[model samples]
Target: MEKAGSPLEQVRSSIAQACKRARREPGDITLVAVSKRHTAATIEPLLIEGHRHFGENRVQEAAEKWPALREAHPAVQLHLVGQLQSNKAEEAAALFDVIHSLDRPSLVKALAKAFDKTGRRVPCFVQVDVGDEPQKGGCPVSDLPALLTQARESDIPLAGLMCLPPAEIEPAPFFAFLDKLARDHGLEGRSMGMSGDYETAIMLGATHVRVGTALFGERPS
Candidate 1:
């Protein structure tokens, strides 16, 4: 039955199975349907079926797409799952319910100011470069404590930790390490994993899984 339904149903079934395998309730994890580069038409069917949580990588794209969707269905929750720029902090804060890429000190300052000015404390996940890739958009593991301190001092509501492991390697260790970091920091949210490794992430205590291609099919280049 799981294999015969729409993508949404299939993804939900998979989540349930993953949760059962991990000995955790399906409700313990938030499945964020990553809708970046997908059109509003592509998203409406899922929305019609009551999938409220959606993630967009770019604030501009979300702005272009979501206003109409939100107008029709007011309960949809939006998340910023991409690297954010300091210059777009206020716009991102106003548009997104959660920011998953709170990595650098500059962004910390920008988001803090935006929240302070707007009186909206958007929940943030401090992204850590667990893969230690210079190209990835995350704070180095060594610099994580300091960044967390700065975020705390700046009054950004720290939701938890987020990470992306290096490509072409086993992600379980990285996910495990991310869980440990969240544990050590007393954070309950671990926004790790994607379509490929979300089951493993759930087993490792991930509170949120950002899934894209698995649910929406492949993205165009």
Candidate 2:
């Protein structure tokens, strides 16, 4: 007899609650609903519900769908939330409104060139490997300062820092560490947190949270 809330409503409610607990204004957090691997048809409902920020993992995949999606919903802000190859810098810069995986010097140089050519200064969050996992996409912790310097020299618009805490363990410490790193660097945007641990991230001062499954449900096999 009682109706269940839609995923968007539930996610928004959770974020609001998290902000309340964190003593932060909900408007301060940019909720990036990661639409990676999901088709445009699957994403339309959230768009219709007025959620405009979305993240994609691959350039090719996004190139396939986002043009039309953006045409239909003109306010949509597309984010690149995966590892970006230097070779695809031009395309990525041309397409995405924001980028969250700027990890290395080469990619920074590439993005700078792309931005100059496109004349579009897309903001980017430098990804840091806080967990130091060899297989992950972020640069190692010690490399962040140099990376940020390179990004600045290249004139890349540094939004802040991002990180993927190791899975299957407590993530709060990692989030807190990222917050400290951002403060040390005088960066305002901390693009940390995801579906599972976003609440913890918000409490630790994440300015952006990339949420997927929690908003769109699990991907099909």
Candidate 3:
């Protein structure tokens, strides 16, 4: 944990340092303060500080917390960073500015119709199973190309690829693999990294980092 500054301030400073180390611009990286399990009361301070990018794990929770928050600060960018259920496609598409969990054919089909119905083309990241973790929700590594094609055919905006590195492992290689996959697919955005390894992700070309604990502390059990 940072010893000298508030969480948000410390994160910003770390992002700056990481960008410096990577020879990249800090402005090029999007910091998504993951606010799931946190009350709107806890999140409002970050909003008041001009932290406009936030992420939520569930559509219903976000719907309950953010409408009032966005009403107060209209420019907030909400990202759906959790595994989205195909049934919740409509609500998720309606609520989030970005959808980072595009992983399967059913979801692609569902979101296509949802986006058409809502007339909102939300930018999406194709979640790749970088760790090949069966417990995870991403598409299999071999299935990525087909999924990308499917999403493109549906006219979904392919922002990039995302992954959750298998926990309790060195994450840098996984981040690098996701970045390479993005490049090979002609995508620019790499939604890799979390609170623990975001700086490494930045150095490896992550355009979006989903930070939660380092900012808000661990989610309460």
lDDT string, candidate 3, 1-221, tens digits: 32457789999999999999999999999999999999998998788777999999999999999999999999999999999999999999899999999999999999999999999999999999999896789999999999999999999999999999999999999999999999899999999889989999999999999999998988977
Model 3 segments beyond 4 Å from truth?
1-4
Q: Which 10 residues in a row give candidate 2 its minimum summed lDDT?
A: 1-10
**Per-model TM-score versus the true fold:** 0.97, 0.97, 0.97
The residue pairs found clashing in candidate 1 are none
The local distance difference test score of model 3 is: 0.94
The window of 10 residues in a row where model 1 has the poorest summed lDDT is 1-10
CA-lDDT, candidates in order: 0.92, 0.93, 0.94
lDDT of 1 by residue, 29-92 (tens): 8999999999999998888888899999998999999999999989998999999999999999
Q: Give the runs in model 1 whose Cα sits over 4 Å from its true position.
A: 1-4
- Measured by TM-score, how close is model 1 to the native structure? 0.97
**Residue 127 lDDT (model 3):** 91
The whole-model C-alpha lDDT of candidate 2 against the native structure comes to 0.93
Q: What are the per-residue Cα lDDT tens digits for candidate 2 across 88-124?
A: 9999999999999999888988999999999999999
Question: Number of clashing residue pairs in every model?
Answer: 0, 0, 0
